[model samples]
Target: MTSLETLLRNTQDVKVIDRSIDYNEYIPLDLSAFNPELSKFDIKCAVSFEEFIEKHLTLNDAKVAFGGYNEQRNLYQRSTVFKDEKTEERNIHIGLDLWIKARTPVLSALDGKVHSFNFNAGFGDYGPTIILEHQLENQIFYTLYGHLSLDSLKDLEIGTVFKKGEQFATLGNAAVNGDYSPHLHFQIIKNIAEKFGDYPGVCSKKELPFYLENCPDPNLLLKITA
Candidate 1:
């Protein structure tokens, strides 16, 4: 039996997202065409890819605006969109997002139970989301899979058990997927404590250290190669 950490550090041909095909060649899609307000989503995806290229990029005081968009950003006062204020503070993305086309199979990272699921709809939102809870050696953790097709969550029920490496659902496109490029928001949470169908994937820079502690580098497990 391979340990989770071993699976993560495994330099051998290990499958990410459970049954996800080895997407050897992939090209990013332009979600801006669908919704200009979603420009920030594209921006975040671009920055994340840039950081992925650097391989060890970590910004401490970097600023990331927090707000979902259906069209284009309104340039809301430089600090907030509606009410939440943070000018020098940008919304820090905690999850590792994969930008690509839709309908890509979403695989189970490990044998876990379907903790909860929901449809978080809104421009720049996670249209469809799913969370899996896994426990090893009494240490439990959860993984959130987001930006999926609406059909993906239509009939899903809570507490459903998924075996490790199962094909759970497919990635969604801009229209149904919160009006952004097709991608997967993969995040790890150490202590969900008591949450259902929802968890924070992005946080303010003010709460970075805590988030960093709670949400470790997913690449530590992804080992992505371009």
Candidate 2:
């Protein structure tokens, strides 16, 4: 039997973004600078999410920005979802964010069936989200695609199957995708428990250990080199 990590590490040619983005067009984005505890990237200074992403794309000289697994970010400060009293301030991003233009086609990394999906609306929510259940050898896991266009949810039903590299959704604009720049928040979950269409994509310093264990770095599957 193959381990999930080994299977993901061995997989190839799997891309979640538009297929046109070749290796030369992609780069890693470090958002730790936005963490007040880390650097001095003041969110107030940026006029809007689009502006923030434009600056990033320009600086990196790349068509798409990717990263954020276990990255501490300050952007969550604007939303109460991460600062609710029950948990510590959740600032660490446990998923890989593919920062690109809106309406870009989003593909599934593996053959899977739609486990659940819904529109999670809020200031910094996922908007239209989808989760797929996949099995690699004997290992069963799940993948999550977030910040999607509302149209992506049209006519979707539970148990709908998709092949690897099949287009299932499109990236949404800031207006509908939690009011942020267009990007696909991709995550891998080992155990979803009872959660239905949603799972915690962000966690605090205190809960980092558990999340880190349950959610492996998506790069393991993406195999995207910086």
Name the best candidate (by lDDT): 2
Candidate 1 clash pair list = 36-71, 36-72, 37-71, 37-72, 64-90, 64-91
Q: What Cα-based lDDT does every candidate model obtain?
A: 0.61, 0.86
lDDT of 2 at 101: 88
lDDT of 1 by residue, 99-121 (tens): 54477678777778898988887
Candidate 2 weakest ten by summed lDDT: 37-46
> Over 4 Å off in model 2, which ranges?
33-47
Q: Candidate 1, TM-score vs. the true structure? A: 0.68
lDDT score of residue 211 within candidate 2: 92
Q: Name the 10 consecutive residues with the lowest summed lDDT in model 1.
A: 62-71
